[model samples]
Target chain A: MDQRPPDHITAAPSLAAKPPIVTLDGVSKAYANGTVALRDVNLSIGRAQFVSLLGPSGCGKSTLLRLIAGLGDLTGGRIDWPGSAKASDGTPKRDLGFVFQEPTLMPWANVFDNVYLPLKLGRLSRKQARPRIMDALAMVGLEKFERSYPRELSGGMKMRVSIARALITRPSVLLMDEPFAALDEITRFRLNDDLLRLWAGRDWTVIFVTHSVYESVYLSNRIVVMGARPGRITADLAIDAPYPRSEAFRMIPAYNEYCRMVSAELHATMGEASPE
Target chain B: MSTSAEPVAQRADRRLIALRIALPILVGVVFLGTWQILVTWLQVPKFVLPAPSLIATAFVDDFASLMGSLWFTLTVTVEAFILAVVGGVALAVLFSQSEIVATALFPYAVILQVTPVVSIAPLIIIWVGYDNVRVALLILAWIVAFFPVLSNTTLGLRSTDHNLRNLMQLYGASRWRILTEVQFPSALPYLLAGMKISGGLSLIGAVVAEFVAGSGASTGLAWRIIEAGNRLDIPRMFAALALLSVLGIAIFGVLSAFEYLMLRHWHESAVRREN
Candidate 1:
């Protein structure tokens, strides 16, 4: 609440002006073995913001994403879904969809069935959910391969199926944990475009976890850079670069400038706590 | 040249299929011919070693009784196999319900698996009442067949992908929904493998239990084999033994076909790679 947030919560001056959808107050997670995965992570994300939690390995970016999605319990502090978007459970995290590092698909099921799972679990009938499933798959460009099994699909295709599945419920928030890390560069770039295209003009919030700073700068409007060794946010950046960013943007000077700024902020934080 | 090339490829494909079928039959024919010639030339006694020709005659001669015995054996085997499939899968589902339950019950299944069926056949017959000998045969066969299904299915259920389970959890799926939608389908390949193994064990159980239970209470192929051996009717024994082999192979074939059909879409073992 200070006029200037303590040095750790640097950046995000523009974020503080917008109404926050989610607020984390002194959130901390510690395992039973006495390892503090995250410590006192104070942050707020506005509605429809594509916020990237970017850090190197062991930075607790993944843990932070999991906690926000309600997949894991935080040992201390709390997270609040402050917007009117509190899904029926009084927390949007329960209703938020997730895309893991792996496609994490049920191999036995076809593309249609895989995409249909969350709806099916919610007790929606196949006939009723067919249109939504098809729409989700088509949005990811996989409608024609609805009958294809996960085994038959390539790595990028599998990730697309995973994206389709995550969006099938039309969740207000989607959490992606390094979803495109395993993909080839060409495939990753295409998927990044496809993902941006999907998130554009939508009201959904996406919290993406990534180790790559360029990925963070390219994909997210707001980047919350964190550091390892009792993980906490070191900087919160708002990439002011305009949308409809394409291959041309990657070659532009402004994009490079933003990446360099995020990169320096990231390295500065990593240098302080990192053992190496 | 392209038109001719297609026909050439089709003809070669047909020849490959023909060879697969013909090769095994060729080996069987050669072995049987050698046996027949040796038996006839050496003037071997039919009581000591029945030639393939003599076995054939006995097959024709006792065709009526053999048919009856075959039907009875097949009936018991099928009944036991069906019971094993249902009971094993059901128990596996129950075991998968709780880790404590699986731990508590798994040892008994292992005991049944390890303790030879032959050792327990007489006891099962006695316990079920000697008059309920057919029921005894069914239970013994079921025990042998059920273990694989129960063990394999539980393994499959346990090995459901961790991330997928987490995904289901995130979606607010209930225990039942997770089991039916994710757990069961994931365990299917393992379940099918168990069924194939159990199918053969069912027949073995029926025959072995009958052998121990003695020939009096039933008229299955096992009873036929014992009766022929006691009378030194070796040709009839060979005929019964042949039926048993054929029956075992048939059950394996059916189960394998079912497995392929179920898993060809996704399972690595069942899919045709070249295609």
Candidate 2:
């Protein structure tokens, strides 16, 4: 393995904050069609840690995220919450925010209503959610687009709204599934920076899924590179760099070095899959 | 997108709108002119087909009698339409909930529609007697026109965005709330489109039933058409036909306008794009 620090590796923040709050044990997933998507995978996520599930396509990264969110039931294994583990928490997994590959917004709804959907569905009335919705919209830099419909929005803005919706719930664990893959390069870059800033500010545990190595390196503190064809974890690279990452960091030699290493790893992973 | 020709563009747009409005009127005038020429030139027998001017004169001369029949027809059409809407939607909601029952009864609805109104109107008139015969006839007409609306609306409800449906489910929206907020709103355009089609259909049904009624009940435009035909008032018959045609067009136009207004904000179908 290459030893150079990732160019976009964020600076190590003070660890006095917290330890990992989430634990998964022997998580094996098999579809109804007898296709095994994940097998005996184990992962533990820390509080406020941004973990990128970096992998080739069909890595079951998204499925794993869904299992965590309680959107999907695991065929085997258990997701344990240390502090809040209980049988009687009436609050559903909907409280856990999920950003899908597509924005998955209600096309009929305006930005404000779409942002407020979760909260409103949680039994909060429109009046109660007005300020919170506005705040979320502002968090995503879409303050001026409250009345705009999804069809009118650009892909980046729509994804931002999705992010805002995920954030609006103040979710402890945010699940993202390649939300920015559809965007152009420039838009993706800006969104990446915005995402990091937001992640830093909120201190929420984020489990992100992406096929892009540069993206995984840029935003993740821990990159979980996965392999497909009956998905399995191949590598987990920890990113140790400084925070408040700027556009300048992407240009540094270290950043390029990390990109090359990840690219090589990805290329090798693809080659290995071809023969099998 | 340039601002320089904005006002000029605005003028051109308004002119375009005016032309769109004028084109239909121009077409109608031309159509009437051709019809009048054909009748006059061919010396088509007046009893068979009267000229437009003759029809107009007959309409004015028999205004009092025609007005009474028109009122009756209008009432039946309105009543039948209202019943169709209220009953169709209620049944649709019921049917949407139970797939088994919906499947069982949907074929029956089709059977009801396919069974000719003439065959049923006479039976209904006899069963209900004279005073309520017209209403019975109207109901017969309505049943046929209503099935499309119900089926279309239910399909629309069923076809709502899966993401939105999941979102609602995640939020733990109650069945009633989901139905009202998501399913119903999504179904509105489809329901309205069906209504536009059924509006004209219901009118025709009412008229046909009235024609079948002969003279026992004078409820719809069909009776007037029959009366004029029986009396050999050819121009009066044309006048009645014209009124029926205009009424059908007007009903459809009204429903379409309502659809446009309702969907203007939310649906792409109703959204007007800049020229």
Candidate 3:
């Protein structure tokens, strides 16, 4: 339990200390059926920052994450990856990892092979990629389950494998879409702690999507609360909680205050969408 | 008490295994015995329904020539099965790559599947020439066997987990890598299922084609059965039929074993669940 607040929040002279790694300018997504999923969204993600897109379902939090990952074609506006633009051939820069809402493990493959997937796609031989694959499985604390298939694992373990696979590429940015939303509370808490530790150990940025106010407050250095009915960002609040935030931090008054603030902003957005 | 219970459980397991083998064998023995006794008591003519004993003696008496014909049929069935698998999988992969190609070609594949091979066997025989009748039979059998592979594999390829596809896209995975590592492995159970159905269908196609061809000395087990029928050698016909049934069972057994071996560790259908 490292009781230190995130170094980026407390240590920086200004909030904009680091240059933006990714910039989403006036982004909008409207399906062909005339449903507006997102509208005029503007956000900048700084290097190594843990940002949570916190909102109710249909607030396009997941959609926003997908747009950042280049999974979907944005209906409007531009997404710029300043560092990744150097290798520009118009393909979304391959320097980002995405973890879906589901564990999404290839049910046919074992943990080792699943984690080795990105490397295999890159044409790295098994002999060349073995160490990195083992390292990733070890990072997720699944080294002993290397040969175990996804079907044999518990829900928490599967999500851990998904995280390991996502981290294997060692991307500059990691985009997660409500990962661990399916897990039980105890498992979720354990994962939240583990995620923070991993964040502290690395220099990569994380853009996490979640509907849980407590989760957003606990994990993120910055929480961007979103609203539905033509999805848009309703509030941008910083959780100045120190890391490594442990089980003890969850009991503190400041943690409750941050949760309340996020919850109030979300309630305000939801109320605005439906008058009744 | 716990130690005593362990051996009791082990004994039960051993008995279950024994029953699994013994039950089917016992039923088969009872069936043969009843048929033999009934036929002998009634003084039934062999032409109508040969007794199990007569069929067995016929099987031994004509063993050499019957085996030669069995070998011929097996070769054709095996060849047709191989071609069906290869062609079906190749086409499925092609379909997976291009929607336009699939749309253009898939209906024709369905048409081929629906049309009876027996009706087309004569045309194939004519086109391929009497000397290459085996090739004609092979083509007809392939037609019967290839569709399940194509349709099932295409479904499997298309049904790849969307999240996994998105993850692959996030990594900028090449088309080939995605196909081999993701789509192909996902399609394994479906492909094996198609193979099993096609295995049986291929045998039927070969036999049907041989029946239609009616080439006397040069043909397969089906031709032997046809010749025996013309001669009213019902016992020999029953013997040939028995051989064909055995071949079908053997084909099914081999395919099932393969499916189990491939999917035992991961697939839901193959892995045993305690609950």
Q: For candidate 1, lDDT tens digit of each residue in A1-276?
A: 122223332367676568877788999999999999999999888878999999979999999998888788989999988765555666664558899999999988899999988888878999999999999988999989999999999999999999999999988888999999999999999999999999999988899999888888899888999999989999888887778888888998767767777777787887842222
Q: How far out, in Å, is residue B197 in model 2?
A: 1.7
lDDT of 1 by residue, B1-275 (tens): 37878788789889999999999999999999999999999999999998999899999999999999999999999999999999999999999998898889889889988999999998899999878899999999999999999989989999999889888888878898889888999999999999999999999999999999895888899999999999999999999999999999999999999999999899999885645
Query: Which of the CAPRI classes, incorrect, acceptable, medium or high, describes model 3?
Result: medium
Off by over 4 Å in 2: A1-20, A84-94, A260-276, B1-4, B37-43, B94-98, B113-130
Whichever of 1 and 3 has more lDDT, that candidate is: 1
Span of ten consecutive residues with least summed lDDT in model 1 chain A: A1-10
Better of 2 and 3 by TM-score: 3
Please give, for residues B206-234, the per-residue lDDT of candidate 3 as tens digits: 99999999886356899999999999999
Which window of 10 residues has the lowest lDDT sum in candidate 2 chain B? B212-221
| Model 1: CA > 4 A from native | A1-10, A84-93, A272-276, B1-12
Candidate 1 lDDT score relative to the true structure: 0.90
TM-score, second chain, candidate 2: 0.92
| Each candidate's DockQ | 0.82, 0.41, 0.80
